[model samples]
Target: MVATVNEFDQTATNPGQRGPAEHQRREQILRAAGEHFRHYGYRKTTVADLAKAIGLSPAYIYKFFVSKQAIGEAVCALCLGERTGALRKIVEETASPVESIRKIYKSLALSGARLFFEDRKMHDIVTASFEERWGNLEAYNHDLIGIIRRVLIRGRELGEFERKTSLEEACRAIQHTMQSFFHPILLEQNLDHLEEDATAVANLVLRSLAP
Candidate 1:
């Protein structure tokens, strides 16, 4: 019996019943906390604020997450996870490696840029994470680079791309060229032409890798 996300009431899934239900409630709390953080900013939003949004008490929030910073890390992970997870689907589902590459870069650039643009407060969480050095930003970058490298390997396997250098070297080049599209601060400066800029850079990337 799979429980739908809508049905997991945190109150019902208490501490004593430790199982999938509890896990679902934790996800709900993270999402609620994310929304709160988006609106109120990290420094301004407290666990009590998240508790209210999740329809639970601050004490209950502790049952799932140790501290507010923990919740922030969870939220960050969820956001990056969703983006990275989609890369595989884009690569496998698309017939053309070039098209897949284009889609991946454009989706990542636009979505990430739009997210921070819409929720300006969320950027503050990123800043806080860097200042504290408690976050796994480096790991996130490495994972993303791995995904791109796999996609490139697939393209090579299909004879759609010609790699002049090693996979590591190519991945580094792509990421370096597209760094502005990935970084929040760098992206914000060129927001007025992000899609066009992303498409242009993506095309250049493909040409650089052409056989």
Candidate 2:
């Protein structure tokens, strides 16, 4: 089942309402948690471990995060939020819809491969998020699909892509086709010749969109 953003957002105070000290404390916790989660793996790390790492008692940690799982969710949200922001920036900078689609696929595959190979330790947290069906995963996908849908609409308006199919269907189908290039769990098995395969898939999707 898909999870909601609230599943992760519930762990922390709303940013707008958070005081200076509260914000600093949360940032400190998240930074320390990220380091521990990357080096020690999320499952092996505990609330007490995090507290000790940051020179705080476990009880103090609990004041900010209710549980270890909540911390994990918050950490996952932070990582996924960075990725989504990067992709959005890519979309904004690229002018052509067709080229934007190509870059998106390339970015997805390259980033996924980086996490799988160079950052396998850090990738564990993301893999757990996928296996456990966390809400942040769905939230990330929703934001990504929205990006693709907007690109598709722009392409159609520019007479660069077919408008026969609805943008919703087109975007969903594109996401389904490109899942292996982006999804962490799925991309692990397709590392060899990843760039070639990603380009081929992107080309195929682009051709299918041709007017």
Candidate 3:
């Protein structure tokens, strides 16, 4: 399910009879939790550590997030929001379907390269959480496939891509290639020139899908 911005805003607000002060406090605590989780892996990070990091009691942290896993999931959701928003914007703005796909792959590679080189710990945490929460990960993959499928459908209608190619097959192929290129291990191994590798993968996929 796509999380709306309104949901994020509502989550920042208090559900009880508390005023703005409580809402602000909750937002601060969530922000602090995100930082702590990014620094320490979800399994190793404790509520007490998060509370201490934010100068709050452990009990207070529990009031905000029922458990560390919940907090980790929230953080992952927020990160996914940011990444998806950027990708969607790129897809919407690009005039060519192939260019849109190329830009999306390039953006992921650039972002992954940064995480791999500058923040290996956070990268590991995100990878672990994504693998552990395979249901959400699979949903995200399908969402990406849907986006590509829409683009392919449009391209076929416009006679830009071959009408003989099945949109579903093309979407699946693109999604598979994207996942293979975006895998953390591949990014880490090709850290020195990930953009180059991403571009090559993009070109190959575009060639296959082109009329």
Candidate 4:
């Protein structure tokens, strides 16, 4: 079974490499639990409620996850994984470097608001995921950076951008400069006009690399 976006329970293994059956089963748990968590808050969303939503026993849920904490982290991973997929697609197929990179940068900054602020249940999941490990955040960050690097290098190849710095330097600089827009806490504090803020920062960075 392919790893569906529904994955809710996991062992912290590479999500891309999880077994199909595991993915399918865990995805069930994730969807139901995620709903419960969002509706009732983490503390209030019990394993029984999660299991009942999916028509499974609480013990069955434990077969796939260690505890409610693991389920919460997996939910966070599921959400982040979606963003990673979106960025990956942008890097792979975008024909216009400037336009696509600007979108990607803006999206990166607005991710927290879209994923967490609008639906705070995801934020609670993230807080839990951060406790024991970065959960999917680390992998998502690594993959996104690689994708951005690819886009930057592609721009240089197409003469859309000047090679002012090494690809490594350029990539890191872009991420670093956009931190104010993308970082969860920072963006959360300045929620209004977030899209505009991110877009402005994105365009500024692109201009800095213009030929």
Candidate 5:
């Protein structure tokens, strides 16, 4: 069976079985795998290669992660977490919901460009996750939409956004509209003028949300 996003999450898959020692070993493997992936790209890095790097056997590695793709998913989760974490911070700290949405667009465009353009090796993992439709990618997208939803809801509450639109519908629509700004492949194509283009898009989206 293919490994699910649950398997990639540190908290969900294992309860009693995942003690500190198990968690440490898993961290070790992930650290080594991340280093190798950053240097050599995910497709070129194998479980055996990770094992050698960390002085563990391939069998031992499998005890933690079921497959190489699982490792890739974990690493990709870390990368995605950084971006979402930034968005969450903006949601909490920004006073204006309208400004929050604007910052979200600019942040995604900037971060996406940095990850996909500067870190080509790590981008390989993201590409694979997208191509394979990994569960973790689905989870990431859900979390992203939830963040957007929070901003939209706050806007409505503060009399900044149209009250007639359905909350869920508005959230999904905004996320879909901004997909190219964050989607790895599509963002890559727009990197040359991403910041400018993203600002224009953000303005358009904000105008649509205005009460």
Candidate 6:
């Protein structure tokens, strides 16, 4: 069974029958670690730094997180939920598969870009963590591809999208083409043109599958 967010939160709060004070302390440390990670890139942020920021000893910090990477994983998990949830909601609500695809792209490009790029340090932390945690990244990519593929398959059944292309191939193409918007390339280019760039990319993919 998939673990719900509440379940995870409960487990974090009550690990091995810990008391309320301990639970609160753990939560406080996690929040401090997140802020440190967001302000300073993962490489620069150390457990000692987090401990100092949170007013805890480095040894006590290790009681909660074994390594800085572990803290980073927790942060990534929380952040990715926002991205996935937004896209999934858009996909489920829209009747037009083409429009759903465009909305997801636009959401990712605009909202996701703002959330990601607003803090340069956080952006670098996420990119580094994503590459280091390849297994997690692969799982996330697979889930996203599966969602898009299902949408395309449904579109074909409804005669909204062309049935000529294989669903898997089409999904792969969309995922691959959309990769640039999430990576470091966006930083190098003038982001003043993001809306046009996002719409152009979305339209290209949508037109390819047009009936």
Higher-scoring candidate on TM-score, 4 or 5: 5
For every model shown, the clashing-pair count is 0, 0, 0, 0, 0, 0
Given candidate 3, what's the lDDT at residue 192?
74
Q: Give per-residue lDDT, candidate 4, residue 167.
A: 87
lDDT of 3: 0.68
Poorly placed runs, candidate 1 (over 4 Å): 1-22, 52-60, 126-139
lDDT of each: 0.74, 0.80, 0.68, 0.73, 0.82, 0.69
lDDT of 6 at 59: 64
What tens-digit string does per-residue lDDT give for candidate 4 at 47-72? 78888889998767766665676677
lDDT of 3 by residue, 42-82 (tens): 66778788889989997665555545665665565556556
Please provide TM-scores, in order, for all candidate models, with all chains considered together.
0.76, 0.87, 0.76, 0.77, 0.89, 0.75
Candidate 6 error regions (>4 Å)? 1-28, 55-64, 130-135, 186-190
Clashing residue pairs for model 3: none
Which ranges of candidate 2 are over 4 A from the true structure? Answer: 1-22
| Tens-digit lDDT track of model 5 for 92-126 | 99999989988999999999988886898887788
Candidate 5, clashing residue pairs?
none
lDDT of 5 at 50: 89
TM-score order, best first, reads 5, 2, 4, 1, 3, 6
User: Across residues 1-211, which tens digit of lDDT does each residue of candidate 6 receive?
Assistant: 1212232223353222122335677678768877887777678888889889988897665555545665666566556656767888888899988888888778777765676568666666667756566233554676678778878987898898998877788899988877756543452353677767878888998899898
Give RMSD to native, each candidate. 7.3, 4.8, 6.3, 5.6, 3.7, 6.5
Candidate 1 lDDT tens digits, 1-211: 1222332233332222223443778778878988888888888888888888878997776766556786787676667667777776787788888898899889878767866777678766764654575454665677778878887898898888996678898998888887777676677777888889899999999998897
**Model 5, C-alpha of 180: deviation from truth (Å):** 0.8
Candidate 5 Cα deviation (angstroms), residue 169? 0.7
What is the alpha-carbon lDDT of model 5 when measured against the actual structure?
0.82
Candidate 5 worst ten-residue window by lDDT: 13-22
